[model samples]
Target: MAVFTVVNETDLAQWMRHYDLGEVVDFRGISSGIENSNYFLTTTRGAFVLTIFEKLTAEQLPFYLDLMRHLASHSVPVPDPVPRDDGALFGILHGKPATIVTKLDGKAELAPGPEHCGEVGQMLARLHLAGRDFKSHQPNLRSLAWWKETVPRIVPFVDGAQRELIVGELAHQEAFFESADYAALPGGPCHCDLFRDNVLFAPAAPGTNHQVRLGGFFDFYFAGCDKWLFDVAVTANDWCVDLATGRFDGARLTALLRAYQTVRPFTPEENRHWRDMLRAGAYRFWVSRLYDYYLPRAAAMLQPHDPTHFERILRERVMHADASPLCN
Candidate 1:
């Protein structure tokens, strides 16, 4: 979500008119994420987000747009894609596949407590259930296969310790993927990147129940057909860990599991391999961060995250093999 491609006001206003969204009052680049060019848009109609795809091709984007539409239609709090006069939810803008989605109200709860974790857990479960009947099929693009292909490309940049960890984890994941335990884990459309920034929270109204509420989950670009258990683990790894030490927050972890189970209970197989799944989640991000760190693209506002953050996370999970946030 950085400004890779600049949009002139004249071009933006012309684009807005096609959606019947009224005059663009103002717009500015959002300089946070690494992949796409995003902008905060203000119009007479309301606030929206403009995303120009940096990697996803036009042919590869409908799955995402349709998935968001499906989730939004199912009462899930997702950013609904606004359609154009041609009735296409996405159209080319500035020679890139672009979309305008209703901006969810609220800010990310970066330092969420148990209640917030619980809310996200519940919503994630609901999203998985809602996506069960979606007709489109797309594999998790950054799954094990990608890791296998990408690891060698980045290993030359790592130190001794980093190299050993990366190699060992890659080997371990390869072996694990061949196991029945991995195969039996439930599969579904998953928000593979559900970190804190991807979720939004609205504060309670003056007369309400007195806490911030989970407003929505956005950033569906990384979503794909994957193990639902992996999705849950990925989420837990991010939402229920202390960043400084990579330690699990037991209260938040427990709350998330408890809330998730209310909608979709974990299978016995999923429960049995929860710790391993945590390792998988950690490994995924660690590899990704390492790749971005060493082989970064040109985005105007880009600073790749520290790969060691998730490295510490993977190391912690490996040490605490006895952890059972939910024993099922």
Candidate 2:
């Protein structure tokens, strides 16, 4: 999270009174992401995360805050938003919608092994199934519609070949989404941004061979209604591949799908359209990185990620996909 708005301790401590939580003990800006202004806050009661909405307005926040509440209600491991005495999930702080959620206990498994990937897959399936009955309906903000609109904005910054690839891939994904197979895909509220850093894993007991255990998922601001397959694809494209080479790691990929299938069986159409979904997932991030890289918002500790990383990933997924029973 970036540091877009600075919150003085006096102002923050004053804001803390609305909830039953005690005096603010520690507050520090989180510097790992580009989306929102986030801080790790500790009170006499417990540790929590403070987030100030950067792009989303107060009106647009209920969807995410409520989604997490719903997921927690369904026994999913999510950080439920802390409500104010007035029973609101958010309050205005520094003139932006601000929220606090209980901090999950663990660190992200950035270099996840097959077991970690399996855990993620199972958890993601649970998350998707848990949101099946959520009341709100917000379209995925960065869906195909967004890609179509965003590509033009970033086109002027790329080379001719990169431009052609972006245009061609968009058209490909557009046609794919319009096809009958896409209609067959299941839709639900999805944790569309389940990258490694968003998940947490705690260390196991000293003697055990197992080093870590899944804690919970957070950062639900990117949550949206989208194809479940797209969610799976988004996660696989990150947790099941080599970061340096952009190649699919077969063992991790297989482990991930095997666990995911145990929770929710995939339809034959999903298997047939798996490759296309993977490509679309890659395209989504590639477009986003380009947007952030070329046209960025001002925020402290915000560094635009390299757009070419996902472009390389898109090329690899296009060229070298593995065959598995999940896709058969």
Candidate 3:
């Protein structure tokens, strides 16, 4: 969501001509993520997010855009991609592939409790189910294959301990991927990057029974077809872990997993492979953060996440694999 390619108001106003979105009132660069150029765009018609693809090509975009449209249509709370006047989901802007999606209401619940995690769990389950019939077949770009390709690229930049941990973890993942248990796990289109910041929540209305409700999930750029357990692991690794220690918060973890289970029961294979899947989730982010920290792309507001954060997480998951139960 970094601003790699700056879009001025005049440029955006001119681009808005392609849509019936009325005149652009204002737009500003968003600086949280490291991948693409993102901005909050407002027009007379409504609020939207403008994203300029940095690495993803036009050929690879339909999978993501169409997936979002599919989930949105199925009543999932996700940002819906807006079409151009000519009916294309995306078109070139500033010589790069760009598109607009309706901005979700509310903000990220960074410091969440059990109730919040419960809502997230339920929504994520619904998201996975809603995406079942989506026909696109993009692989998770940052999965095992990517780790194999990327580990060597960042090896020279890491210390001996970091190098050893990554190499060993990668080898373990390779073997696990070859196992029948891994193969038997239920698979689907997954939000592979459903970190705490990717979700939004708002306080419940005055008469509501809950403290807050999930506004929506956003940032579908990292989504792909993968094991559903892997998605659950990725989400739990963030939403249910203590920031200081990288240890699972038992109450929150239980709430989240139970809520998700109510929607979609876990398969026996998923239960058997749960711990390793957690390690895999941690490893994925560690590799990516290391790469982004050591080899960064230039963006106007880019801030690479600290690689050590996930290093601590991976180490914790490796050391305390049995410390938390999978679900109720």
Cα-based lDDT for every prediction: 0.89, 0.87, 0.89
Show model 1 residue runs off by greater than 4 Å.
Answer: 23-26, 298-301
* Worst 10 contiguous positions by lDDT, candidate 2: 319-328
lDDT string, candidate 2, 165-253, tens digits = 89998998999999998998998999998988899998876888765678999888778999999999999989988989777788898
RMSD in Å for candidate 3, one decimal?
Answer: 2.2
**TM-score of each predicted structure versus truth:** 0.93, 0.92, 0.92
Model 3 clash tally, residue pairs = 0
Could you give candidate 1's per-residue lDDT for residues 125-204 as a string of tens digits? 99999999999999998889999999999999988988898899888888888999888888889999999999999987
User: Which residue pairs collide, candidate 1?
Assistant: none
Kindly report which residue stretches of model 3 are placed more than 4 angstroms away from their true locations once superposed: 1-4, 23-28, 298-301
Residue pairs with backbone atoms closer than 3 Å in model 3 (clashes): none
- Tell me the tens digit of each residue's lDDT in model 3 across 1-328: 4687998867887788888888788788997776788899898999999999988899988999999999999999888889999999999988899999999989998999999999999999999898889997989999999999999999999999988999999999999999999989988999999988999998798988988888899888899999988999999999998998888888999988999999999888887778899999999999998888888766522666777888998998888766545542
Estimate candidate 3's alpha-carbon lDDT, on a 0 to 1 scale: 0.89
Candidate 1 accuracy as TM-score? 0.93
